[model samples]
Target: MDDNDEDNERFVRLLRQVFRFLHLVLHVLAGVFLTAILVGLQRRATDPSYRSLKRWWLHRVVKIIGGQVSVYGEPAPVGSLLASNHVSWLDIPLLGGQTELTFLSKSEVKDWPVLGWLAAKSGTLFIERGKRDGAKGASECIAKRLEQQERVLMFPEGTTSDNKNTLPFHARLFAAAVTAQAPIQPVAIHYLNMQGQTHPLVPYLTPQTLMQNLWAILAEPKILIEVHFLASIDSQSVPRKALATYTEQQIRLALRLNSA
Candidate 1:
C-alpha cells in the first residue's frame, strides 16, 4: 500500500479506538449512578427484582464495551454450582448478563473502585484468599446458599491466565457442592478478536493494573466471548477432590485443551 494509504488507515483505527474508549467510560459512569440508586432501594440481596436490575445493568455494560457473547450450552439450574475458568474482569459482566448467579470473588475486590461497590451491592460473596481456613469458611457459606436454591459461580483457578490453557483447579470450593448435594457445572470461557483468533489483551494477568487491562479491552474494535457449559456432574456421588478433578477435565476438554 502507498504511504498516504497506510497513514490514513492508522488514523482511522486510532479514531475508532478513541470512540470505543469514550463509549466505555460513559457507560461505566451511568452504571455507577444506577447502582447507587439500586443500593438505596434496600432490597434483600436475594430478591428477584434486585438480581433482574443487576443483570440488566450488566447487559448494558457488555454492550457498551463491544463484547459479543455466544453461548454453546444451557447453564445449570439455580441450585447448582458453576465452576468456570478465569479469563478477565470482563468475565464477571459476561456471565452476569447471562444469569442471575452470585459470584465468589477475592475479599480484596471489595476495595476496588466503582466495580467493587457495584459488586457489593449485588451481593457478591468475598473470601479472604490467604487465610488458613478461608476456603473452608467460604465453602460452608456456599453450601448454605445452595440449600437456599441460589446459584453460585466460582473460578477455581484462583487466578487469571491467558486464554490458551486451563490452570489446575483448587478443590476446596468443590466441597460446597458435596455438602449441598448440588450439581457441579463446568464452564469454559474463551475470548477472540474480530479475526476469530485468541486475543492476548483480554487476560488480566500479572503486572497489568485493572485500568491498563480495561483500556486494552476498550481499544479492541471487537471482542467475541464464547461460554461453553458442559454436562453437570452429581456432586453427591463423588468426593470433593474427585469432583474438582472431573469438573476441571470437562472444562479443559470443552476448551480443546489436553487434560494435563
Candidate 2:
C-alpha cells in the first residue's frame, strides 16, 4: 500500500477507537447507575432477582466494550463451585454475563472506584490476603454460599496472569467445596483478537491501573473471549489439595498448557 493509503487506514482506526471509548464510558455509567438503584431494593445479598439484574447489566457492559464471548461447555449446577484461571479483569463481566454466580475477589478490590461498588452490590466475597485467618473466613463464606445453592466463582491463581498460560491454583478455596460437598467445576478462559490469535491487551498486569487497561481495551477494535467449562469433580471424593490439583490440571489441559 502507498503512504497515503496507510495514513487513511490509520485515521479510520483512530476514529473507531475514539467512538468505542466514548460508548464504553457512557454505557458503563448508565449501567452502574441503574444497578445501584436495584441494589437498594435487594432484600438480601443472594437474592435471585438482584442477580438477574447484575447479569443483564454485565452483558450490556461486555457488548459495549466490543467483547464477544463463546462458551464451550455447560456450567455445573447452580450450587457448585466454579474454579477458573485469572486472565483479566474482564473475566468477571464475561462469566457473570452468562451465569448467576458471585465472585470471590481480593479485599483490595473493595477500595477500587466504580468496580468496587458494583462488585459489592453484586454480592462479591472479598478475601483479605496475607491475613492470618483470611483463607479460613473466605472458605467458610464459600461453603455457606454453596450450601445455599448459589454458585460461587473463584480464580484460584489468587492473582491475574498473562492469558498465554495457566497459573498454579491455590488450595485454600477448594476446602469450601469439599466441606460443602459441592461439585467443583473447572473453567478455562482465553482472550483473542479479531484475527482469532491470543490477545495481549486484556491482561491487567502489574504497573497498569484500571483506567489504563480500560483505555487499551477500548482502543482495540474487537476482543473475542472463549470460556470452557470442563467436567465437574465430586468434592466429596477427594481432599481439598487434591481437588485443587485436579481442577487445575483439567483447566490447563483445556487451555492446551502442560500440567504442572
For each candidate, the alpha-carbon lDDT, in order, equals 0.88, 0.88
lDDT of 2: 0.88
Give the total clashing residue pairs for model 1. 0
Stretch of 10 with least lDDT, candidate 1: 34-43
Best by TM-score: 1
Encode model 2's per-residue lDDT on 47-138: one tens digit a residue.
Answer: 76777778887787788778888899998988899999998888898998888888999999999888788788778999999999999999
TM-score for each predicted model, relative to the true structure: 0.94, 0.94
lDDT at 79, model 2:
88
Model 2, backbone clash pairs (residues 3+ apart or across chains), number: 0
Off by over 4 Å in 1: 1-3
